[model samples]
Target: IGLGVIKNVTLKSGEVNGLKISEGKLAGFIRIRDSGKAELTAIGKFVNSKFFHHLRNSLILATLTVFLTLLFVVPAAYAFSRLKFFGREHILYFYLMFTQVAGGLGIAGLIALYGMLVKLGLYNKLPALAIIYAAGSVPFNTWLLKSYIDSISPDFDEAALVDGASYLQIIRYVLLPMALPGIATVAVMSFIGGWTEFILASLLLTEENQPLSVWIYTLMGGIGRGIDWNYFAAAALLFALPVFIMFMLAQNYIRSGLTVGGLKE
Candidate 1:
């Protein structure tokens, strides 16, 4: 049923009693809540209460994170797949793997990271936050893209080289087209990571720059204030919508990329 149609319907006494059943409890709750309005709820108290700003902040951060990740990962993965440098495998397997594993240091590492950002004067900056997101994404994305690139026959690279294409040209004209599925997979993962991340965002960002993830927390109100379930529900749904749509659109590519990338190595 449409929300507007449901909103206009008046429940009879018997229907209201029937709605008290477990199966109808969720509908009951939604029905009892008022629209998020300034006069009616605490959600309207904050001057920055407009969700558009939070959504725009998230989009900017997520887009920058995806761009930075692809810029660094694509070239690095191509090098790892094509080059014969000394310690290439060792560096890829050991150093890159270590970076991924070290991320588990969690709060301890975040503390140090916070200190460094403060010293660098990048605290609360969106671009800097995107950089951090990109850095964390690099190791795994490089490995994934490299594995996908390795699956592509080196004959393509050799043919491009013989046709007078430089490595950059080959990457742009040759590998990238063939490896698009992998790249899309990486982009989607990076976007979701930046979009839904809460802890780091909560710590690094202030109110004016808060993303939807952190903004939801502020909607919960401070101590001694009654929680507004309706406002929280609305904000949470809005926060989830983009990620849901992206995943639905990209699930096929994600599945194929992961499957094909794993096949070679």
Candidate 2:
């Protein structure tokens, strides 16, 4: 009878007057809830929200962070790799130190950063978030790209210069082409920083502007219990899909970068 009751929606209503039982829509909902159907329904809603609302700001952040990182990091990395300017090593030491410091800031720093954003009227602005992402990524991306460029002999730069090419021209026509893998690596990392960020995204965006990270975090409210596992699962899956696909497409470039850039570090 429970099997039939499972099919019928009336089993949701327990014994009436301690005797009668009617399976109805309530029973159907419960049955469906536990069976993943309800979760799938929630997933659809989550995907729709992601595409319609979050995708806009999230894409904006990703694109700007990548573009700005490439713009600034290429020159900085080139100089670091090829120039013998004073304090260059000291600058790198400071960058590495800053990386350690930033990593240890934890939640307190995140909240403080967000508070300052509000004070500066930057809260809830996607462009502001992009700026932060780009700036924060600088120390790491610069170091990474610099190391990659260094692995290539300075002879490459000299070759271009001997050809009457300007510094900018050499960077544009020579160094950048050779460092394509490293650039792609930095771009992907910057994109991830913008896309998967949760704490900052949550604090910086309004309800209508929240991204997949916030959606996945806030959907169930509590962990392990008092939560709808299906909805959370579905949201998590959707949240990860785009990044996953991109990673697959980028896997080759990433490998080349790590192979070239990894040994230098």
Candidate 3:
């Protein structure tokens, strides 16, 4: 459906009130097309396609993954930043190496991981999948958060210690507040990672437990099947909406976090 009819009109050069139209053929041109039905049909299909179920599963996985990542990373990064211990530097190096090397965890490693998950009856479990995502995230997030924590002054820790504050108190009162930007950064990254991760999600989860990412993949249509580009495109757009909103909301925190964490004081 269109709003106005295209008609030839005579107009002088630089005629301010004239409605100028293109002289050439307009292929696939929509001056004012109403796509409400198409959009509603796509949204209706998405709603009826059990996307909410997959979305819930994804939210669970991403949220759980972020929780687990922060749970482990905060303390680990604090220790790495403030504590002096044997082989501390080497351990940090080891973490970096692991992140660089096993980051992808290649096909063979995935096969082995799959078998292990199967043996443990973790296959298709959302929590188990969250654990895997959190574990994968820990190394990098720890490194990132540690950098931010390092930028904080130790005088706060000393002052707290002098006042008989425990390490936990110092972490809670001092580190956490000051390190919030970096924490936000880690959380955003981890959530995005877990939300969008496909290979592991597809391999480990069944249809009922599949995430929106995997669900979108199924929209592509399988063997001898034709793709519904409109539906697929709409679904894909909706799928990415959450992450986009998250990033936009946390844009400032992420920028500051990266800026500070990238530099050491």
Candidate 4:
């Protein structure tokens, strides 16, 4: 039965327990004893609604973007940390400088660039956001990962190489396992960063393709009216809960990972 129809029922007697029959209503009803179950059902329904669906999709997209970032970041960082190559230090310095300088101010140029892409029929696309988020994450992720990789013992890679393992094989069998802690750190950081990212997402996405942050922004007034504080608060809390949960789940990994490469001498 609908919420409106639920009010039509009247309790009859003191000792009575009967769902009063309605004409064309009352699909189901639980007593006060079943209120807990009813509440759970309602909450489940709400979470499965369109609002939650978009929230869920945005979270998934952010997560996937982070994972893709790690896919490239781990290897790149390992190479930068372990391999000797020309211009390597220069590249690292460039990335550090880029990270330091490329903050909110760089966004206007990026927005204009995406706007041009949109005019070319690529606006509000997931790939665009993914590409942007992935690129934005790389500098910090690479540097963080490089630090972790540098802390690892070169003896492991040497031993693996002496065992006739190819570079790809060594990466898969040796480095990845040893770098788990660092990987977790990068993944968690990237996921958290992308999950709560608003400005870039807002600029890249249109109404139909908007992420939760953009959608939540829409609840505020455009003209003269005040904000919808209630809806805004609810949406904000909902948006925050997943990221909070994600961090809580990864907290153990992050701590253990950080300590994994500590001093041996």
Best by lDDT: 3
Number of backbone-clashing residue pairs for each candidate, in the order shown: 0, 6, 0, 0
Question: Model 4: how far is 36 from its true place, Å?
Answer: 25
Local distance difference test, each candidate: 0.76, 0.71, 0.79, 0.70
TM-score per candidate, in order?
0.75, 0.73, 0.79, 0.75
Model 2 regions lying over 4 Å from their true place: 1-51, 106-108, 222-226, 252-265
Highest TM-score scorer: 3
Ranking of all candidate structures by their TM-score, best first: 3, 1, 4, 2
lDDT of the structure predicted as candidate 1: 0.76
Worst 10 contiguous positions by lDDT, candidate 1? 37-46
Over 10-74, each residue of candidate 4 has an lDDT whose tens digit, in order, gives 43322213223333322233223334222112332333235665686587668777878988898
lDDT score at residue 30, model 1, on the 0-100 scale: 29
Writing each residue's lDDT as its tens digit, candidate 1 over 1-265 gives 2232123223222333222323332332223335432121223222224588889999999999999999999999999999999988788877566666765865669888889889999999999999989988888889988998988989888888887999999899887777878888888889998998888998888889989888888878888977868667877887889888777767776566444322122
Report the candidate with higher TM-score, 3 versus 4. 3
Q: Flag regions of model 3 displaced more than 4 Å.
A: 1-40, 104-106, 252-265
lDDT of 3 at 71: 98
Choose 2 or 4, whichever is better by TM-score. Answer: 4
Candidate with better lDDT, 1 vs 3: 3
